[model samples]
Every structure is written in C-alpha cells, then in structure tokens.
Target: MDNNAILNVAHLNIKFGGIIALKDINFHVPRASITALIGPNGAGKTTVFNCLTGFYKGGPGSKLTLSSKNKSNNLVEMLGEGFKLQDFINPPAFVKRIYFKMFGGTHLVCRAGLARTFQNNRLFEEMSVVENLLVAQHMSLEKSLLKGVFQTKDYLESQERALDKAHDWLKFFKLDKRANDIAGELPYGEQKRLEIARAMCTSPELLCLDEPAAGLNPAESAELSELIIRLRDEHRISVLIIEHDMHLVMKIADHIVVLNYGEVLFDGTPAEVRNSSKVIDAYLGKE
Candidate 1:
C-alpha cells in the first residue's frame, strides 16, 4: 500500500468451477486520477470490478488493498492477514466470520473513502430524490441515530447538517429542481445523474463507475464525460471507470487498462492504449 496509490490489486485470480475467469491481474489506481478499464465482451472486466468491490472474491494470492494518506492504517491490514479469496468465494465453516469480514470490507473501503455506482441504475424508487441522497449518507448519519432517537439537541443539529450536505450534492449534479420528485419518476438520464450524485454524497476518495454511459444519448454521454472530468479536477476524487463507450473513455481517462480473455493486453495512457495493436486485435479483431 503506497502512500500515492488509492487502490492496489495484485495477483488476482477468479475461477468459477472449471472456468478461469480472471488470471493474475495486477493494477494500481492512483489517487485523484481517472483510470478506464476497456475490453471486448467476456474480457473479465466486470469480474475484476466485482473482486475490487467485494461483490466476488478472488482465488488464492488474490490481494485487494486500499490505502489513503488521510486514513491512519491500511484497510487491508486491519482486515487481518490471510484474508484469501477462497475464504470469501467458497462457503467457510465460520459463516459469521465471513459475514463480518464482508461488511468490514465495505465499511473500511467506504471509510477509507471509496464509493461506486452499478451499471444498472439503483435508486430507491419510492423515495424522493432528496431522500435517495440522504439514504446514501447513512454512514455519516449513524453517529447521530441513537441521539436522534432520543430527540437530543445534537441529533437535531446533525440532521440539519446532513440535509444541507445532501442539498449541496443535488445542486452539484444540477438536480435541485427535482429535489422533491420521486427517484423513479425522473427520466433515465436524470436517474443516472442521481446515482452519481448519491455516490458523491458518500464523500468517497475514489469512485468506481460501471458503464455509466450505457443508455445515454450522444448529448447525454457528453454531459456524463464532463461530469466525470469535473469530479476529477474540481472535486479531487479519484475515478476508476469500466465502460464500453470508446468515445466516453477517450474523453476523460488519464490512463487505460485493456484486458483480453482474462489477461492484461495493455496498460498505459489513453493514447498508448488506443494505438496498441493488441487492443485493436482484442476489440476490432485481426483481418
């Protein structure tokens, strides 16, 4: 865990029965930089994201660690030694231990300042836009829950602060006009923006977005690209994006990691990746 790196994935491997999904992948996502993962379909890109986000654990020697200069200790170290992938992927004898570790992983990751949004827009359909943002701030609100239940003065103050912060993010995403609208009532593009806004409300040091431009029109995708760049330059949040949109990837990525058949075909700046023969072969195929 270097002071400069936000996320470090080393020797990661994932196997489903006899299928080798990912093999010996290693990459570092630097602090405050935007990195893009691009490859053809079935290239194990999403699997890598799953492993990083704790959705799926890797095999032996698969180590995923996150380090933040503002945080006191390494999140991986706190999780303890020998936190192997098999222990997480396969059912272990101690279900509770695994559960604790999984929750701890997410908590430490978020606490270490990381957030993410899925490819499919996930919102509280019944909740208002403001409610959705507020829900995403649960970690911050936890400190006041007990006090608030007792109607303590501090609880009221904390509630007000959380509301203000939520409002600020809504404004940041240009969703202030729909603050009281139900999340599900918003248009597709607005929902996508709300998802990003919700993740931003978490105050993450690093944000991982999965195919955010999937359903956007050309104009909307352009706006998404601008929003991503703004997040990097203005908010200073490191971003790791997994997208299939070449135009969007090229527009904002500081670096690119190209995968092919579960292996690293290329890793470099956007210009290098775009020019690589291997990337071309992987995506466009050889003549």
Candidate 2:
C-alpha cells in the first residue's frame, strides 16, 4: 500500500464461473487525486468498480483495502471472506473479520468512507431531487425508532441537518431551483450532475464514478472535467473513474490505467499513455 493512497487494490481476481474477468488487477487511488481507468468496451472496467463498491467479491488472496481518517478497511474481507494468515497473528484483524462476516454488506462499504455512481443514472425516478439526495444520507443518519415516531427534537434536528446537506450539494450542482422537481424530469446532463451530487452528500473520502461522461455532449463533458478537478482540489476527494471519453480522461486524470481483455496494458501518466505504442495499437488507435 502506498502511504499516501486512499485506496489500494492488490492481487484482484474475479471470475464468473469459468470466465476470468479480471486477473491480478492492481492500482491505487492517490489521496485527493483524480485517477482514470480507461479501456475498450467489455474490458472489465465496470467490474473493477463493482468490486470496489462491494457489489462483487474477489477470489481469495484478492485484497481491496480502503485507508482514510486513520482507519483502514479490507473491503473484500468486509464482504465476508474468512481470515488470512496475517489475521491469525493480528488479534484486531481476526476479530474484525468475524464481525464483517456476521454483519458486512454493500451498504457497509458506503459507510466506510467510499461512495459511487453507476454508469447509467440510478436516480430515484419518482423521487424529488432533494429526496434523492436525502436518501443517500440514510446510512449516516440516526435511526432511533422511538424518537422518529414521537418527532423528538433530536430526531428533527438530525433530519434538518440532512436536508441542509442535501441542499448544499444541490446548490453546488446548480440544481437548487429544481429541488422540488422529479429527479427523472431533469435534463440528461443535469441528471448526471445530480447523481454525482447525491454521491457527494455521502461525504466519502473516495468517490468512484462509472463512465460519468458517457451521455454528455462535448461542452458538458468539458464541464464535467472541470468539476472532477474541483472535486479533487476544492473538496479534497480522491476519484476513481471509468471513462471512454479519451479527451476528458486525458484532460483531468493525474494518473491513467489502461485495460484490455481484463488485463492492465499500461499504467502511467497521461503523457506516457499517449506515447505508448502498446496503448496506441490496442485501443487509442481504434479511437
């Protein structure tokens, strides 16, 4: 693990029955930096995101560790993998593995300072924009049943705070005026921004975006590029993005990882990726 990395992936291997989807995939998202994962369609880019966000589990010896706020979590372990050799020697780790096996889930991953948006917009279509954002904060909110039924002061205050946070992000994304409108009613570009805003409301140290620029026009993609940079510089959030928009990736990525047939073909800066004959021949040439 890099001392400065917010997320570290080592020896990641995924299989759907006999088909090997990802083999020994490894990378790290540096703290407060933008890292881009680029590849052709069916290159297992989204599979990596699914694994990171806890939708899929890697095979044994595949470790996904998230480090932030002086705490570290083994995501694969949290998703119910048993003890490793190291855990046997480390008492705390051994106990945590037991706890995760009993109580761990995809929701736990979000609670562990990581949040993500899907490739397709996964907004609550029938819900209002503000409602969608508030829902994202549900895990962080206190859920005392008695207080909620009685409308206690503490419960009301917490709800108010959640709403304030929701609107804060809505305003940042320039969706404040549409806060009362249906999330599905918003324009496609605004819907994309809203989804990112919803993820931000979770207050994650690391944000994973799956092809955020997929449906945007050129101008919208340029704006997204600027917003991603701001997310790193202004909000101090590390981002891991899976994107096909080479222009957007080259413009904003501090580091790039190129994948082909579920294997890493290149890992370097934007300049190195641009200059690599292997990357050029494999994917960029087709572009």
Candidate 3:
C-alpha cells in the first residue's frame, strides 16, 4: 500500500454463498490523477465502486482505505461524525450494506471526500439543474440551514459559495443556460455533463465515474475526456473511472487498470495498457 495514495483497496474478496464475485482485488488511486478501470460487462466494475462508496460490503479480508493530506489524516477517523470507528471496522454483508446506505448512505461517502456518478444519470428528475447541484452539498449546507432560513450573514455566505461552485461547474460544462431547467428534461449528452458537475459540487478529492462516456457520440466523448482532464488538473480532483470508452481512457488517463473476471489483468500507463497483448485478449479483444 502506498502511504500517499488517496485510496488503497487490497485483498478484497466477495462471495454470494456458493458463488464468488471478486477475488483478491487490489488497486490504488493516486492523488490528483486519473486512473481508468476498464472491462467488459459483468466484470465486477460496479461491484467494486459499490464496495468503495459503502453501498456493498465485501465478505472477509476486504480492505478499502481512504486517506487525506490535511494533517495526513485518515478519513475513517473524522468522517461519519459522531459514529464510532468500530462501526466501519467491520462492514456488513452485501444485502445489509444496501440497508446501511439508507441510514449513512453514499452521502457519508461524499463527506469522507469520495463521490461517484452512476453509469445511468442519477439526478433529481424534477429538480432544476442548479437545484440538483445545490442538493449535493447536503451536508455542508445543512450545517448552516438555520442561518440560511434567517438569511444571516454566515448562511448567506455559505449559500453564495455553494451557488458559485455550481455556476462554475455549469459554465465549465457549457450548461449555464440550462441551470434553471428540469434536470431530466435535458438531452442525454448535457445530462451526462450535469451528472459530472453535480458530483463536482460535493468537493470530492477523488471522483469515481462509472461509464461516463456511454451513449455519447465521438464529439461528446472527446469533450468529456477534456472535461475529465480539467477536473484533475484545474479542480485538483483524483478520478477513478470505470469506462468502456477506450479512446477516452487512452486520452486522459494517467494510469489504466484492466479487469477481467473481477481481477486485475493489467495496470500501467496509457501507453503501456494500449500496447498490452494481455489487455487486448482480455478486454480490447481484437479491435
């Protein structure tokens, strides 16, 4: 485990009674970089994401560790405030993990400095674009709610900051004009951008994106590649992406990991991954 790695997942093994899902999986997400996880369908990509964000817990010997540079702290120490470390020391089973979210949920994951977007856009359908972004600041904004309700200076400042962050993301994605429109009403490409922007609003140190380029045309995917790069370079966020878009992955990823049957087949730079015969056989598969 690299001490500096923002996320270190090691020895992760999951099973369903008689069937195994993931076996001895291990990976690290470096700070302020883009690492792509690519594989075919049922390759255990989403299962990996679910486990990291606390939606699904692994069976035994599963270790998912997150770190922070501030005071060189471990997020497990401060996050899930008022909750004891014992609670997460041993996570629940796969089914119980789903119910855990209803209480602590992915929002707890967000507060821990990791946030994710689904392969399918998971937005508040009826909420306006900006509203969706604002809602993602659930934890931060809630702390100032009373002041906001009274329009006090502290809350007003907090609200302004949140809105400013939202506007910046919207502008970056070229969707400032659609900020007031209902989220679901937007076209697919714009909706994709919105989803990324919404995740950005949470101020995550590492953003996990699942198949962000799915359904996007070449032009849109190219632009998304640039956006992802900008997120890493400009916004200072590390990215762990599970995407099938090889072109986009090759374009923006600093590191790439190829997964086959829930285990890592290859892990290296874009050039290395692009040139690997093993990856070709397991994932790329004869062009």
**Top TM-score model:** 2
> Higher TM-score: candidate 2 or 3?
2
Worst 10 residues of 2 by lDDT: 278-287
lDDT of 3 by residue, 33-148 (tens): 99999887888989888878766666556767777535343332222223335556656543344454346555566777888999888989999999999998766673755775
Across 151-233, the per-residue lDDT of candidate 1 in tens digits comes to 88877776788889989988888899999999999999999999999998888888999999999999999988998999899
lDDT of 2 at 204: 95
Give the least accurate 10-residue stretch of model 1, judged by summed lDDT.
72-81
Residue pairs in candidate 1 whose N, alpha carbon or C atoms collide under 3 angstroms: 113-205
Q: Estimate each model's TM-score.
A: 0.88, 0.93, 0.86
Off by over 4 Å in 2: 82-98, 284-287
What C-alpha lDDT do the candidate models reach, one value each?
Answer: 0.83, 0.91, 0.81
Total backbone collisions for each predicted model: 1, 0, 0
26-82: candidate 2 lDDT, tens digit per residue: 888899999999988898999999989889888777889899757998788778786
When summed lDDT is taken over every stretch of 10 residues in candidate 3, the lowest stretch is: 73-82
- Of the two candidates 1 and 3, the one with more favorable lDDT, higher being better, is 1
